[model samples]
Target chain A: MRIPLKIGDAFVYGFAVVLVIISFAGMYLMGAKSDRRHVVIEMDKREIYSIEIHEGMEPVELRVDAGDGRYNEVVVMNGEVRIEEANCPDQLCVKSGAIRSSGQTIVCLPHKLVVRITGAGGEPSDVDDIAH
Target chain B: MKRYIAKACPMALAICLLFLPILQGCAINEVREHSKNLFALNTWINIRIYAGREGPKIIDSAVRRIEEIERRMSVTIKDSDVSRINDNAGIQPVKVHEDTFKVIEKALEYAKLSKGAFDITVYPIVQLWGITTEHPRVPTDEEIREKLKFVDYQKVILNEDEGTVYLQEKGMGIDLGAIAKGYAADEVVRVLREEGVQHALINMGGNVIVVGNKPNGQPWRIGIQDPRSDGVQQHIAVVEAVNESVVSSGDYERYIKDVYQKTGVRYHHIFDPATGYPANQGLMATTVVAENSADADALSTIVFVMGAEKGLGLVEQIGNAEALAVTVDKKIYTTKGFDRRLTVTNEEYEIVP
Candidate 1:
C-alpha cells in the first residue's frame, strides 16, 4: 500500500512542533537562577553580617549585642540558621527553629536582631512587605 | 488552490506561536514600574515607590524628606532638634523647626488621651534603662523613682507661635522615640504625594504607612508582626490597609530578660512614665491603624501600655483609628473596625470580637 502525504497535514504537524519548541524556550529562559544559600543578619535595621551556607562547614556561633545589653546568640550548622539563645525577655528567636530556605528569618526584637536565610535560586519566601 | 491556502494558514499560526512569548513579555512591561530603596532614617527606612517616568525622582525626594525628619527628630543624633530640646531642658527653651513643634504638640495630645501612659518626657527613665544600648540594666528602685519625677509629658511646654519647646525641670528630656517614626512616615507620604506619585509604601522599621491602593487597584495588605514571632514572616494577622498606617509596639522588639535570676522579669524599652519601667498592663503588644503613621505609632504604644480593655475603648473613640491588642494570655482583641479588616493567620491565638 502507498501512503499519500498532504501539505496541509504537514503544516499542522510543523505548527505543533513549533509551539512545543517555543514553550520550552520560554520555560528555559525563565528557569530558576543560581542556588546559593546566604545567611544574613540584621541588627537595628542594618545588615551586620552575612555568610554563605555550605556542607561540612564548621558550626558558626554569633553573639550580637544591640549596645543596650540585649544579647542574641545565633548558630549556623549544616546550612541551617538557628537562634540558639537570646537575652531578650521573650526567647522567640530561640523557638524559631532551624531555617535553611531563603526568606526565613529568626527575629529577636529585644535584641533588635534579625537573622534571615536567602538565596535558593529565587527570592526568599518571606512576607511581601511592600508597604515599606 | 484551496489546499495551498489551508497549508498557508497553518504556516502563519506556527509563526505566531514562535513570537507569542515575546509579545506577552512586552505587554507585561506596561505595568507600573516599582522601585525600592532602603537606608537609615531614624531606623532603617524602607520605601517602595510606584510610578511612571518620575519614579526614581519621586523616591529621591521621599528619601530627602525622611532624612530631614530624622535630622530634626532623632534623639540618638546629638545635634537633632529633639537633642537640642533635651540640651536646653530647664536651662532654657529651645526653638525647634515647626515640624518638631507640631509633633511635640501631637505627642502631648496622646499623653493627655492616655493619661501619661505614653509620655515623651520619659527620656530620663529611658536613659536609665538604656534598653536599646549595651548597658541596659534594671535600675535601682530609688534611681527609677528619682527619674520618674521628670517623666512628665505635661512638663513639655510647646510654644507653637515661637516654635519653641521647653522642659520644665532640669532633668526633664523629650524623646520622640515612640512617635518619631510615624511622623517620618507621614512626611515621606507627603513628599510622595507632592511628587504626584499615587502609590507607595514606607516602612520605618515596623511602622508601615501606605499611600493609595496598589498599582493594580487592590488594597495593600499590611502584616501585623506577631508579638511572639520567632521568624520575620510570621504574622499573627494581616490588615487590608488603604491610605493608612499600621504600626505595632511590643515588648518583644527590644528587651533584656533576666530569667536566670528566676524573677522572670523582662526589661523592655517602652517605659511607663508612672513606674519608670516597661509598661506592665498585661499586654504583650498593640497594633494600631490610623490615617497618619505618627498617630498610629504613638497609639500603638499607648494601647500597649493601656492594656486590652482601655485600649479598645480609646480606639473606639478615635475616628479613623483601629487597634489590635495581643494580651499576655495570647488572646487577640481588636477594635470593631479592625476586626472586620484583619485576617488572622496564626491559629495559636484567638481573635476576640
Candidate 2:
C-alpha cells in the first residue's frame, strides 16, 4: 500500500524529529554536567576538604575539628556524604542524613560547619540560595 | 484527512514540549538574579534578589548594611554598642548607635511580650553554660541559679532620648545572638525595598525573610528544618511565603555535647531564665512566621520554652503571628492559622488538628 504525503505533513514530521533530537541532546548534556560528584566540607565559610563520591567504594570517615574541641565526624558511604557524629549538643549534623544530590547541604550552625554536595567546582552555580 | 490531522496534532504538541528547555533558558537571564556571601553578620547569608540588572548592587549594599549592624551590635567587638554596655554594666549608662538602640528597644519589647521568655539579659547565664564558647559545660544547679540573678531584662534600662543602654547589675552582660540575626534580615528587606527590589529572599543562618513573591509571582518555599532529622536539609514542612519571616529555635541549634548520649539528655543553649537550665518544657523545636523578623526570632524560643499547648495559645493571641511546635515525642503542632499555609512533608509526625 502506498500513502501520499503532503508538503505540510512532511514539514511536521521533520520538525518533530528535529525537536526530539534537540531535546535529547540537551538532556544528555545536562546529565553529563551533573555527573561530576564531589562533597565539600567547610567550617566558618572556609573550605576544609572536597572528596569525590566514587560508587562502590568503601566507607570513609573523616573527623574535622573546628578548633577548641568542636568536632564533626563526616562519613562517606554508599555514594553519599553524611555526618556520623558531632560534639554539638543537638547532633543536628548527625540527624541530617546522607546527601548525594548536588546543592544538598547539611549545616551544623553551632560549629559553623557546612557539608555541601556539588557537581563540579562547588554547589551548582545556578542556585542562588539554599533557604532552609 | 482527519486521521492525519490527529497524528499531526500530537506531534506538534510533543515538539512544543521538547522546546520547553529552550524557552526556559531564554527566560533565565531576565528572571534569575542572586547574590550570596559569608562575610556579613559572621554567618553565611544568601540573598536571592529578583530584580533587573540592579540586583547585584542591591545585594552588595544589603551585605554592607548587615556588616554595619554587626559592628554596632556585636558584643565581641570591643567598641561595639553591646560591648560598651557589657563593659560598663552598673558602671555607667553607655551611649550607642541609633540602630543598636532600636534593636535593644525591640528586644526589650519582646522581653515584655513573652514575659521574659526571650530575655537579652540572659548573657551571664549563657556565658556560664558556655555553649558557643571554648569552655562549654553543663553548669550545676547552684551555678545556674547564681548566674540567673543577672538574667533580668528589666535591669537593661534603655534611654531612647539619650541613646544609652544601662545594665543595672554590676556583672550583667547582654548577648544579641538570638534577635540580631532577625534584625539583620529585616534591615536587608528594608535595604532591598529602598533599592526598588520587589522579590527577594534573605537567609542569615536560617532566619529566612522574604520580601514580596518570586519573580514569577509564586510564593517562595521556606522549609522548616526537621528537628529530629540528622540532615539540616531534611525539612519536615514547607511553608509558602510572601513578605514574611520564618525563624526557628530548637535545642539543636547550639548545645554542649550530649555527654550521656544514651540517657538522651542534651545541654542546649536556650536557657530558661527562671530555672537557669536549657528550657526543657519538652519541645524539640519551634518555628515562628511573622511580618517582623525580630518577633519571629524571639517567639521561636519563647514558644519552644513554653511547650506546645501554651505556645500555640500565645501565637494565637498575638495577631499576625503563627507558630509550629515539634515536641519531644515527634508530634507537630501548628497554630490554627498555620495549617492553611504549611504543607507537611514528613509522615512520621502527625500534624495536630
Candidate 3:
C-alpha cells in the first residue's frame, strides 16, 4: 500500500538528522577546545603554580625561589617552557632546554624544584612513562 | 498517513538511542586515577593507581613503605643500616634489617653474575667523585687509585643465618643506590597488587615499572630517554610493556655541567671500579627490561659499564631479560628478544643488527 507524504513525518526525519549532527559537532568542538596544555611548577613536593598554554599566547617569565638564596628563572612562550636561569650549583635545569610536549619535565635536584607539562590534550600521550 | 508517521517517529527515536550508550560508555570506562609525587631515595617518585575508592590509602601505604626502605638503606642517613655497616667495616659484622640483608644478597648476586662489573663496593669511588653531591669535581688519578682499593665486592661478607653484613676492608662501603630504587619499585608493585590494583605505573626516578596493562586494556608504552638530549620528552625509542620493569642508566642523568661546558667532557656519575673513573665505554647509555625491577636496575649499570658487545652478550645469557645499548656514535644494539618490542623514534639513531 502506498502512503502519501505527510508534513509530520518530514519534520520527524529532519529533527533526527539535526540531532545527530549536533551531537557529533559537540564532541568535536569539545575535543578541540581542550587541546590547551598546562605547565605545572612544583617546589618541595607541592604545586606552586599552574598555567595553561595555547597558541598565540604571550610569553611569560616566572621567578621561582627555593629559599636559601636559590632561584630558577622559568620562561613560557609559544607553547614551550624552559628554565632560562638557575642559581643551583649544577645548572642542569638550565641546560635541560625547552619542553613543549606533555609529560616533559625540568628538574633541579638541589632545590627540589620540578617544572613539568601535564594534561590530556586533544590526543592521548604516546607513552605512559619514560625510562632514563 | 497516521501509521506512516508513527513508524517514522519510532525509527528516529531508535537512531538517537543508538549513540546514547556510546557516550555513556565513555564516562563509565573512565576509572578514577589516584597519583602521588614525592621525593624519596634522593629522587622524585611518581605513582599512579587506577583502582577505585581505595587508591589514596594504597598510595599512602606505598609511600610509607618507600620511606621505610630509604631509612634502612640510605647511606647519607646517620644511623641507617648501611651507614652502620660502613662504620663497622673490618671491625665487626653489623646486623641489618631483613630488607637490607635481602638487597645486599641480590647486589652480590649481580656482582658475581657480571664478574664484579656491578660491584656494590664502588661507593668509595662514588664518594671520591661526588658527582651527585653539591661539590662535584674530577678527582686526581692518585686520589682515585687510593679509593679503588676498597672497590671490591668479594670483600663484602654476608651471613644469611644471622642477617648480618660485614666488610673485610675498613674503608670499604656498599652503596645500594643502583639497586635500591628498583627494589622499592618492586615493593610498591606488591602493595598495589595486594590491594587489587590491576593497572598502575610506578616511576622511581627514571626506573619505571608498569602493573598490568593500561586501564583501557592497551599495553603500557614506555619511552627510552635520548641520552644526548636533555629534554625529558626527547626519547630515542618507545617500547610496549605489560607488567614488566624498564630501567636505563646514562651519563646524562648526573654530571658536572660546568666542567662539561669548559672541557667538552662529561664527568658523569656511573663509575667503573676497575679504572676508578667514569666508565668510558663507547656506549652513551644502557637500558634493561626484565620481570624484576631490581635485576633490571643493577643490569642497566652493569651493561653501561660493560659496553655494547659484552653487555648484549650478558643480557642474552640471562633468559627472560632484554637490553638495549646506545653507542656514542648514535647506534643502538639490542638483544635478540627485543625484536618487535622496541621502536626507534629518533631519526638520528640507527638500530644496528
Candidate 4:
C-alpha cells in the first residue's frame, strides 16, 4: 500500500469526510434540541378554556369563560408532573393540576381565566427577533 | 505522479478547511454592524453618542443620566422611583424621570390599546409563573387569583405634569419586560442625536433603534430570524431611512425544554396578561416597525398575544402603525403598503391575504 492514497480515493473519501463533518456539525449545533418554540394548543373544540404551558410549572394561560359560567365545574389539576383540566368550581384547579413537564398545565376555566405551557424554544417562524 | 497529486489534493483540502474559519470571521464586522449595542455584553448598555463636536461625550453623559432614570423608574428592580410612585399611586402627584414616566405612561397606553392584553403590572403574575428562570413551578389557583389582585396596569399611575409615578396598590409591582428594551432603544437613539451622530444603530438585544442611515448613505440590512429555525438567519429587512425602530416579538427565547409530551411540543416566554397565561394567538411571532423602538418593542408583544388577525386590526386601528405576523403554520401576515418594505426568504412564506 502506498503511503499516499491515490487521488481518486482521496477525492471520494474527502467528499464523504466532508459530508460526515457537515452532518456531525449540524447535529452538534442542534444538540438534543437547540432553539425551537412550538405553540401547540391542545383542546376540545367544544371546550372554552385553553391551557398554555411554557417552561413553568404554573399554568401560563387560564381563560375564564364568563359566558360558560361554570367555574366550580371547571377543574384544574397539577399533580406530580402532569396537570389535567376537569370540571369543577372555576377549577380552583389553580391547585388540583399536574403538569409533568416544566411548562405544562391544565385549565378548566375560561373567561374566568386561561392556562398555557411553553417548551424549549421552537421555531414557528422567525425567532431571531429577540434571541439575537 | 498519482501519489504526488493525491498528496497535493489533501494539502489543498486542508488549506480550504483552514480558510473556512476566516471566511466566517467576516461576520465579526458584520456582527458589529448588526450588534445594535455599543456597550459590552451583559453590561449596562452604552451607545456611542455622535451629535457634533460636543456629541459623543455629551451623548455618553446623557446615556448615563438615562440609566439612573431607568434605575429609579424601572418596574423590575424594586423601590425605584417607579416603585415608590406605584406605592403612592392613589395619592397623586410625585416626580420622576420625564423619560421613565413617559415610558411607563406609554406602557399604560399600550395596555389600553390591547384592552389590557399588554400590561406592565404583570410582574406578580410573571414571577408566580417564573417565565425567565428555571424551577418553573405552577402556582396554586388561589395564588394566581390573589396575585391577580396586584396585577393592574391602571394601578400604574403616572403624572406627566408633576413628573411623578405611583403604584396605586401596595405589593403591586410593574415589570417592563414587555417594553423596557424598546424604551431603552429610544433613549439611546435620542442620546445619539444629541451627541451629533448622524448615523447609528442601537440594538438592545433584538430590540433595535436605527438612527440615520450609515455614514456611507447605505441602508442597514437587518436579518429577521426565521420563526422555524434555530441559530439561523431568516429574511433581512433593510432600513435605508433613519429614525425607525424594528422590534420583533417571536415565540422563541427565554423558555424551558421538555415541557410537553405530545409530539414536538415546546414552550415560549411571551405570556398573555389577560389570562395570566401564555397567549393562544395563532401567531408564532410578530414584528413591528415604528417611529421609535419603544413603540415597536411593546406593540410586537401586544400584537403577538392578540394573534395575526386581531393583532393586525389593532395595528390598523392605531393608524400609522404597521406590523408583520408569522403564524404557526409558517405564513407571514404583513400590513398594507408594507410589501415594499419586507423581504421574504422564499416562497415558503406568503403575505396573509
Choose the strongest candidate by DockQ: 3
Tens digit per residue, CA lDDT, model 1, B1-353: 67667667766776677667666666544435454435455355567777766677788787778778888988888999999989888898898998898889999998998888989998888899877775678789999889888888778887777889999889888888888788888988998888887888777877888889888788888777777663344677778888999888888767875531467676777777888878988888888889998899988888888888997788788765888889888888988756888778788888888
Q: Against the true structure, whose lDDT is highest?
A: 3
Across B58-124, the per-residue lDDT of candidate 3 in tens digits comes to 9999999999999999999989999999999999999999999999999999899889889999999
When only chain A is evaluated, what TM-score does every model earn? 0.64, 0.64, 0.68, 0.36
Report how closely model 4 matches the true complex, as a DockQ value: 0.04
Residue ranges of candidate 2 with Cα displaced over 4 Å: A1-103, A107-132, B1-29, B39-42, B260-262
Residues A16-122, candidate 1, lDDT per residue (tens digit)?
77776777676565543225777888886578888888767889998887786778888888888888877776566787688777645566655667777665633
Clashing pairs in model 3, backbone N/Cα/C closer than 3 A: none
Q: Rank the candidates by lDDT, best first.
A: 3, 2, 1, 4
Model 1 chain B: ten consecutive residues of lowest lDDT: B28-37
The candidate 3 chain A region of ten consecutive residues with least summed lDDT is A117-126
Off by over 4 Å in 1: A1-127, A130-132, B1-42, B259-262
DockQ class, candidate 4: incorrect
TM-score of chain A of 3: 0.68
Model 2 over residues A1-132: C-alpha lDDT tens digits?
Answer: 335667986787687778777876886797686667778888876888978786777888999998888899999976688898889855767877777766567777678888877664333322333233
In model 2, the clashing pairs are: A94-B230, A95-B229, A95-B230, A95-B231, A96-B230, A96-B231, A97-B231
Off by over 4 Å in 3: A1-37, A56-60, A76-80, A98-103, B1-30
Q: How many backbone clashes does candidate 4 have?
A: 95
Sort by TM-score, best first. 3, 2, 1, 4
TM-score of each: 0.73, 0.75, 0.84, 0.60
